[model samples]
Target: MKYVVVIGDGMVDLPLKELDGKTPLQQAKTPNMDFIAKNGSCGMLQTVPPGMAPGSDVANLSIMGYDPKKYYTGRGPLEAASIGAELSDDDVGFRCNFITEDEGRLDDFNAGHISTAEASQLIEALNQHFYRYGKFYLGTSYRHLFVYKKKDAATLESTPPHDVVGEPITEHLLKPENDPLAIKLNELMYKTSKILEKHPVNQKRLDKGKKLANMIWLWGQGTKPQMPPFVDTYGIKGATITGVDLIKGIGTYLGLTNVHVPGATGYYDTDYCGKVNFALEALQDHDLVFIHVEAPDEAGHAGDIQEKILAIERIDRRILGKLLEELPSLGDYAIAILPDHPTPIDVRTHTSDPIPYAMYSPGCESDKTEAYNESSVENSFKNSSKELMEGYKFLKFFIDYSQCKKA
Candidate 1:
């Protein structure tokens, strides 16, 4: 049997008063997702484990069938793997984001969604000045990496920039303020601001009235992780299609092929159709293909209600709609749709909420869910015996649910 999982990253949201008190999922037209819910099963899955921060790295790891508590090191190491930045045992990889600091506040986490070409030049200047501390590796956009040789640096508590936008930068810098490593890293961040402030890239951005990537905010640090490959754990060869480096990094470590699609931008303009087309092509050789879209998540983070709704619709129409049409050619396929976690439009950050999911496989008994959305799944979940399943267990349940009917 073939398997496909479409992950609409941070697609779920709380009910917003502006959207007529309906969540984005409820407000958006998702007939394809609703079809799966109607024909298959619908319930909630706790993608982010209790007590863990609801970052994409943790949540997606859980969805990929690896318990985050057991396997998650940090977000940095994952992106490092995706960008081909090898981390040594003593090296602590930190997720370096080019952010805008205004009047000592964290003005913007993404530096106005700076272009990759502009970021590349900034990355080069950073490495030139900070080579003694660590080398910066360019990933994409404002997302980058810095590998510090000291393992102790991993213990420093650095806050995610996206989580604290408009907050005082000093209040959120590397914590336990007395630690030497924390002090050093925090000082490095301040120094970075000086270098970036005068750079030609920032000068051009200033001329254009764009947010300056004038400071590097470092967080999510960890050494390399030790885990079994995807095939060893699940006995299925899987591939991943995503624009985000973090997802690609997870796939890299799990022995899953990272299918590169030129139009997958990890932004609002990301090519939804191209991602599905690539996943379909990858399925020709892979047992399972995970199609992860980041646009919805980006909209959620930006708190753009219309954009989030648009992204959800695009996923339903362009990705899931197409996948439903084409998967039948492969025969006996199981298709599942769910988000990694809730990046509530109001909250504007990842939340540890149980995400709704719908899965369909020919011949399996359906729960008769009429729609795919937060409210629909919650109502269905109350009537079903399946409580909120753990994120890691969902993969096994999905595969077994499909295989049991064949047997």
Candidate 2:
């Protein structure tokens, strides 16, 4: 028996009036997702635990069966691992986003989705100036990273740039008084902004009438954390396929191989079929393969309803559709599909609401769900309580069930 988990990041959403009060999942044509719901048990899973932030760091950790309260440190350390930035015990990691600011207001969080090559040059310039206090490493596009040598920096409170888009930048500067290391971080950000504003990169962007990647926003700080490897926890080797560093970082620490798929950009333009091809090939050697798609989440953050719907349809057709058609040839397998959290279109951020999930196994009992969406799962739950279960709990159950069947 084999296992596959498909995570459509921030795929869940609230109902929209434009779609006749239907959520994107309901409005989108997701035949493959609907097929899973029809043949498998469906339920609402609370991926984000109580009192935890609804970021992918905590949510994906919980989805993988590790309790966030026990294992989660911060988002920075995870991304650090993905980019091969080794951190010492005393070092702290931070996610440094290259953003655009205008007239003291927060503009684009992604700086017009700046190209990695261009962002790399900007990060290199930042390293030349601030390499003594902390070092900057380019990851992807505006999603870069910084590692602070001081442990106290990990305690600093910084807001995610995405959460503060279109707001005043002054109101959201990092609070540094609480920690001396934070003071350094706050000071560095100001200095870096001044330097970046006049840099050649910003000048070029201005010439093009593009959003300038003028400032570095720091958030999601933490030291390296210790957690049991996934193989030890599940007794099955696994691989991960994702374009996002945070998810790939989690997989790296969990002893999972990261499958790099060309053109898998973690955006709407990502090559969806490439991810499916890599995942299928990975399954040939591993017992489990996890695939994460970030397009829906990005669309949600941009508050573009049509893009979100289109992303969902693409995942259904390109990723899951290909897997369902090919996996049967390999052997008996179970596929679990769910989002890490809800990036609602209206809110343009993650919500702590429970997300709907479906698990399809050969010859397994069905919940009679016809489509994969929030409303359909709610209706299915009303008919039977057997499908209702916690998100983290399902991970363990799925592993054990597959192990038993394999034996």
Candidate 3:
């Protein structure tokens, strides 16, 4: 089976500072992607809907032609279920994060780049002490993947209390103010902190000149997803290569395997070559490969435009370049690469705008474009989402329109 490899970092788009300012793609050097966009079909895609609450989770589903409202139960359980964590009809799931909380004020976020092991230990410790019918699962360190179930609906109403970055976690917490059932969350938060404070793993890392994993704050609490399995719906197996817990969790929830490679970094400084290799190999074992990179969004979230550009450029050369180089050897497969959403470096938040998108079928179009952006591809025949779906109508038509082909 031929596979369409979707390669791009996870979402967290920016509100481009200047109306006419260059996009991250325009600013970054993406020769191979630019070449693909120009050689084949390209256009502006509103991967997310016209007016939907935006997130990488929803954008990806939309790009794949799944309606967000129909498919997204919530992103948390998908990530949770990805890591072997399970949820039920009565259960609630949340994305818990081990961000840097101040030891002095306990107010600051971004706890100095805490490592995953420290975060995992903290979650394990938190997991050890659960009262009644609630459960918390730790994922990839920075993300605390949690699930809860109560017999009564009242038990699940309280939600994760996070509004903006750097908001006092103390002020925004599981409380009666937000949820009557939130009384026990602050206890869990304090417990998770104390456990991290003395964790031998953290202490050992600190001794090794590594950042100490500190506090955890819960956010993105959501319900379990109900989307049909890809194999069931698309007649093809799918797998993802990513470190971000939510995407991994989603892949897991959908029963998609998370690809692991030798020398895999599992984070921003990840091995880009390793990711492309995973995509190429997936062609043999599966029908679709979802290669999710996290660094660009991380850079954008950090307000580091230069770093975001570097991440994009680096991936373009290392990951995207390697994939294209190997394409000739692996005949008959098409490549479609698009971002789940725009991660504008300066703004560092998910923005609702049509992003530049493209698809490349070998021998379809021979000319490579110099760059990739919104306005470059509208003049071509590959004008709609259906035309861009790599010979399948499953994505753009929102149904089983796979009775025909362009290849």
Per lDDT, the best of the predicted structures is 1
Clashes of each: 0, 0, 11
User: Listing every candidate in turn, what is its Cα RMSD in Å to the true structure after a full C-alpha superposition?
Assistant: 0.7, 1.6, 4.5
Evaluate all candidate structures by whole-model CA lDDT and list the values in order.
0.94, 0.88, 0.62
Q: Order the candidates by TM-score, highest first.
A: 1, 2, 3
Give the least accurate 10-residue stretch of model 2, judged by summed lDDT.
398-407
How many clashing pairs does model 1 include?
A: 0
> TM-scores across all candidates?
0.99, 0.96, 0.81
- How big is the positional error of residue 220 in model 2, measured in Å on the Cα after superposition? 0.5
Model 2 lDDT per residue over 91-157, tens place:
8999989988889888999999998988988998999988887899889988988998888778777
Candidate 2's TM-score reads 0.96
Model 2 pairs whose backbones collide: none
lDDT of 1 by residue, 1-407 (tens): 79999999999999999988899999999999999999998889998999999999999999999999999999999999999999989999999999999999999999999999999999999999989999999999999999999999888898999999999999999989999999999999999999999999999999999999999999999989988999999999999999999999999999999999998999999999899999999999999999999999999999999999999999999999998999999988999999999999999999998999999998897999979999988999998898889999999999998986668
Ranking by lDDT: 1, 2, 3
Estimate the lDDT of model 3. 0.62
Candidate 1 at residue 241, lDDT?
94
Q: Give the TM-score of candidate 1.
A: 0.99
lDDT for each residue of candidate 3 in 47-129, tens digit (9 for 90 to 100): 66665655777776666545676767666666777667777777777666665565433332444556566666666666675
Choose 2 or 3, whichever is better by TM-score: 2
